[model samples]
Structure formats: structure tokens, C-alpha cells
Target: MITVELTRFRVSPGLSEALLAARSAMLRDFRADRDGFLDARLVRLADDEWLDIVSWRSSADLAASRAKGGNRPGIRAFFELIGEIVSSEEGTAVEEAV
Candidate 1:
């Protein structure tokens, strides 16, 4: 089953652009190097608050990726930009569309 990962976090005020750039780079790296990256999306919940939704082929893939955190420059840069992480959770995807 596909695994859906949701992470909610806040970035420092006035750093949205940099945060997005870092996220883009990090995603590019993940798609290139990670084994089961399906896709990812970034959404703004409110000023300074954002959500990262990522999809993987299976729960094991999500766990493996989390275990190998921030090992590259892009991923490390993305991690450094977060001011606070509100929550993170993963579960089986019930449905998916293009």
C-alpha cells in the first residue's frame, strides 16, 4: 500500500521563498536518490505555517527515508530552514489521484 506522510511546520517569518527553494532542491535529490519517492507537495496553512505531504510506495519506504535523514546538502538545507515542527505522521493512503 502507498504511504502518505504529512508534516506540519513553521518557518521563520520572511523566509518563505528560501524555504520553498530548499524544499524544491531537497525533493529533487529525493527523487534522484531515494528508492520509493512517489511525489511531494507543499501547502501553506497560515503565515509561517506550512505542510509537507509526501508519498511513497510503502510504509517501509517512508521509514527508511526518515531513518536516513538530511544526509545530503539539499536535505540538510531544508532541515535548517524549519523554525518548528508541529507534527508528523504517516499512514496508508486510502486514495490517490493524478
Candidate 2:
């Protein structure tokens, strides 16, 4: 089953654009080469709130990636820009259309 990981967070004041740029760089330079990584998107919800949606082939793939840690330079840069994590969840996709 496909797995989707959703992470919601708020960025430090005046850092939204920096966070987005760092995320883009991380995806382009790092995540794109990872196993089972399907896609990733960063979305702005409110003035400071944001969402990170990532899709993977399976739960194992997500776990493996997590084990590797987001300690790389680009990922670390992105993480540093976040002020707080609102929520994070992972689940299998439902078959029904929205």
C-alpha cells in the first residue's frame, strides 16, 4: 500500500520563503535520489503555518528514510527554519476518490 506522510508546522517569523527554498533544494539534491520516494510538496496554510506532504511506495520505505535521519545539510537547513511542529502523521491511502 502507498503511504502518505503529512507534517504540519509553523515557521519562524519571516522565514517562510527560506523554508520553502531549503525544502526545494533538499528535494532536488537529496530526496529525489532516495529509494521509494514518490513525491513531496510544501504548502502554506496560513501566515506561518505550513504542510509537508510526502508520498512513498510503502511504510518500510518511509521508515528507512526516517532511520537515515534528516541530518544532511539541506534538510537540516529546512528543519532549522521551523518554529514548531503542529502535527505529523502517516497512513495508507484510501482507494476512494476525493
Candidate 3:
């Protein structure tokens, strides 16, 4: 089954741009080499709140990638710009016709 990972967090006072840039770079560099990585979305909910949603082909694929730390050249810097995670969840996607 497809796996979707959701991570919600609060950003530092004025680091939105930097955090976004890092996230973009990290996805660009990492996704190409990841087996089940489908796509990712970054959303700004409020002034300080943000959400990251990632999709994978399967839960196993997500687990394997995460076990390797999900780190690419810019991932560490991306993580550093974010604050504590407010919530996180992962589960199989519910299939439905578009």
C-alpha cells in the first residue's frame, strides 16, 4: 500500500525562506535516489506553523529510507532550521478514483 507521512512543526521566527530553500534542495537531491519516494509537499499553515507531507510507494520503502536517516547533502541543514515537531503521522493511503 502507498504510505503517506505527515510532519507538522513550527518554524523559527524568520527562517521560513531558508527552511524552504533547504527543503527544496534536500528533495531535489534525495528523491531521485530513493526507491519509493513519490513526491512531497511543504505547506505553511500559519505564521509559525508548517506541514510537510511525503508520499512513498509503500510502507517498506518509507521504512528503508528512514532507516538510512533520510539524509542527503542538505537534509541536515533543512532539519536544523525547523523547531520542535508538533505532530507526525504515517499510514497507508486510502485508495479512491480521482
Candidate 4:
């Protein structure tokens, strides 16, 4: 089953450009390095708050990715841009009509 990993965080003031660039770099690294990465989305909840919804092929894949995320330069850069992480959660995605 697909696993959806959701993360919410806030960025410091006047760092939107750097944050976007860092996110882009991280996405490229994830695509190249992480297995079972299906897709991801970055959503803005407020002026400085944001949400990241990432879908993996399975729970194992998500776990594997998480284990290596902090080691990757792009992922590290992305996190550096975040002032604080508000929340994080993961679960099996509910099936939907397609």
C-alpha cells in the first residue's frame, strides 16, 4: 500500500526564495536517490507555514528514504531553511476512486 508522509514546517522571514530553491534541490535528489518515490507536493498554509505531502510506494520505502534523508546534502539544505517543524506523520493512504 502507498504510504503518505505529511510534514508541516515554518520558514524564517524573507527566506522564501532560498526555501523554494532548496526544496527543488531536495526533490531532484529524492528522485535520483530514493526508491519507491511516487510523488510529492509542497503547500503553503500561511505566510511562513508550509506543508509537505509525499507519497511513497510502500511503508518500507518511506522508512528507507527517511533513514537517508538527513545524510543527503539537498535534504539537509531544505531542512536548514525551515525555522521549525510543526508536525510530521505517516500512514497508509486510503484508496480513492480514480
RMSD of each: 1.1, 2.1, 1.7, 1.5
Model 1: residues >4 Å from true position, as ranges? Answer: none
Candidate 2, residues 14-96: lDDT per residue as tens digits? 88778877877688645555689988877889869999988989999988888876657776787788899999999898773
Candidate lDDT values, in order: 0.90, 0.82, 0.83, 0.89
Give the runs in model 3 whose Cα sits over 4 Å from its true position. none
Give the TM-score of each candidate: 0.94, 0.86, 0.86, 0.89
Clashes (N, CA, C under 3 Å) per candidate = 0, 0, 0, 0
lDDT of 3 by residue, 49-93 (tens): 999888999988888877766466676678788788999889888
Candidate 4 residue 68 Cα shift, in angstroms, is: 1.1
lDDT of 4: 0.89
Candidate 1 lDDT tens digits, 1-98? 89999999999998899998888789888987778999999999977899999999988888899888988889889999999999999988887687
Locate the minimum summed-lDDT window of 10 residues in model 1: 89-98
Ordering by lDDT:
1, 4, 3, 2
Higher-ranked by lDDT: 1 or 2: 1
In angstroms, give how far residue 3 of model 1 lies from its true place.
Answer: 0.2
Give the candidate order by descending TM-score: 1, 4, 3, 2
Tell me the RMSD of model 3 versus the true structure: 1.7
Which structure is stronger by lDDT: 1 or 4?
Answer: 1
